[model samples]
Target: MAEKKFRSGFVAIIGRPNVGKSSIMNKLVGEKVAIVSNKPQTTRTKIMGVVNGEDWQIVFLDTPGLHKPRTKLGEYMMKQASEAREGVDAVLCVVDGQHIGPGDRAVMEDVARMNCPKFLAVNKVDVTTPEGLMPQLQQLATIGFDEIVAVSALRGDNMDKLKDLLSGAMPEGPKYFPDDMITDQPERLICAEIIREKALLNLREEIPHGVGVEMLAITKLSDKLTEIHANVYCERASHKSIIIGKQGAMLQRIGSQARYDIERLLDTKVLLKLWVKVREDWRNRTGDLRAQGYED
Candidate 1:
């Protein structure tokens, strides 16, 4: 009997802010490759998540949520999001199933111009009833998506089916990533993102987008323990105070939450040290943006 041929390709996951694109990518990869938060525009760069199947490998690019740019950092993020679809084998355009608004249409319109196979994914089905989703589904059906699947990425609903659909879309090619490899992101970058995600979860709504976490150092203190130092930058002194809290309570909470996930990620105990700093208007300054690792 002949053996099955290997297949591999890239899939760009694009959607507007807070549409669960990162959640879906994390679910599909079966690991947290991208940082996720409820706040809009949480992702500031293009993160790569790899899924290895029996005979196929799918490389997924989890990009920043597409939105109008207001600052230099925002412009960089938008560029990263838009360029992700170029030369990809497929494009998975995600949207919120509960709310199909003009933002959804704008993203789909851009996807419509792509040359690759376009797949539409309606997420958040777990929160929406069949009746509630019907109108949205009907409206989406009119679009020219090669395939459409409604899923709840958080609950793992229909994820396996979605994986199969994505795997089937790949072309016969070499295995792009090794079986054990799940992402292209460096450990330092992932750790920084992890810290940033924790901060986003703990901070107030207005504070997340302006927050940036930079990994200063990761030193192996022993075989069982590692030490990590990070700086959390905000746009104002008041935001810095809020992040640190009175008597350092808020900073402690952020570090405590981040260390748990970091330990799981690195497979060793971590001593995470966090410091709050104010880089006023860093988002609008190109040099500061690059210093914060926002370069394309």
Candidate 2:
């Protein structure tokens, strides 16, 4: 009998803002490893989601969208996306099917500059027409991608084909993560992200970007329950008030939604205590950014 061959590699998902990269990551892993929002740049760091199969394990690195940086934090996000492309076995360049604009071209150009196996996934195909998609496909083809696949990350369209393409691209190697593990992020960090995601979903524009979630402490009170205290940091006092809302109504709503998701994620009862604090100009402050897990 011949020995079975096992394959494993790192695959980086890169794209412009709100191109459904995080959504695809969740679809691939069959779980919410990265936070998803209709808001652009919802992902500010590289989040790893592991996909284990019978003979292959793909560690997907979901990165922040590539864009021109306007602030210190934005610059850091762009840098993180660039760094994630290095040495990956494959690059999954995602693009929205409704329209391909300058942002998509710029991201494609960046991927072209990298020496790696690259594949293009035209995402959100369910929302666009074939006539509307031809130009985008033609434009993407001009960039010389190894493969182009049309998929709706939300609807799970043609994702199995994408998986097969990725599996073939990966080189033979031992698995980097255990089979049962789904992601590399710590539970506390994921909890913080869940809180931040709830804030992003409930709050209006500008408020979500100005906010950050920090896990102050997480204590395992018993087998069935855990106590988590977190602070929601905003860049201004008005933003703090916006998050707290009238008589803490907004804060309560955010807390309830986040705690429920956290419980589902951990499979335990979560006692989540949330508070809002103001940290003036945190986006530009190195110390503040570093404290909030944004790399300097």
Candidate 3:
């Protein structure tokens, strides 16, 4: 008798800003495929994380948080989140457990309008009580979700159960990617994101929403070491100074931290070179937006 083949499909995780959607994606994939920060709108693109199981493979997409757009870039990010729902096996609409506000309701309404197999994932359950969870889940359920799962993306609570549920919902199909692969993102893109995340962490509120990291050069120096040169582009000279810092100290710190994380992710030593440049309000410029990989 022949052995049985398994199934695989795509699952999109959507939610409002700072709602732990990226955290849940990282936890689900067992790796940091998406960057996590306390700041809102940190994730600005669609990232693919592959979860391999004994009998199934799930290609999970971590999208930018949905919100009311105030700029072209914000609108693009929202569009990316909306587009993820078009042709996926399942939609995991993540919401904060502690607070069920209008933002969560707006995203739930958008998911309902998709008319797909949707599930509600209440994240940050580690911070919520059983009593609080009940009301939140009940409120979200009324918005028309097919299933509900409570999970703590930070603590890994109920993540396995969530995976099982997602895998069960996938249609019978061959694996989209190999089991050894964890993500479909390019190494340069990942490196750029790592640098950007480090900036986001270090700069905090000093930087604006138009910052982007461009990998200018990457070269293998030896079997264990690589040389990388990247430029951080901002909308103004003042923002550039903020990123570069006094006596270039801030940029050095950002580069060191980012290089350490990149080395761990790539499993090799890296020499990171960082530069800050002003693009003069690049967020609204078509050419600049395309260069930053945000062009839709």
Q: Which candidate leads the pack in TM-score?
A: 1
Q: What tens-digit string does per-residue lDDT give for candidate 3 at 1-296?
A: 99877988999999888889999989989999888887889999898999988889999999998878877788888889878776898899998898879878988898877766888898898999989789777766777888899999989999999998998888889988987788877888889988988888888674746678888888988879999998899887888888888999899998999999999987889989887888876666777667667767
Query: How high a TM-score does candidate 2 get?
Result: 0.96
lDDT of 1 by residue, 51-153 (tens): 9888889999999988889888889998898788778999999999988889889889879778878889999999999899988888787888888899999
**Comparison by TM-score, 1 against 3, better one:** 1
What pairs collide in candidate 3? none
lDDT of each: 0.89, 0.89, 0.86
Q: What lDDT does model 3 reach?
A: 0.86
User: Which pairs in model 1 have colliding backbones?
Assistant: none
Off by over 4 Å in 3: 2-5, 206-208
Each candidate structure's TM-score, on Cα atoms with residue i matched to residue i, is: 0.97, 0.96, 0.94
Residue 192 lDDT in model 2? 88
lDDT of 2 by residue, 39-98 (tens): 888898899999988899999999998878888899999888878888899999998998
- Clashes, model 1: 0
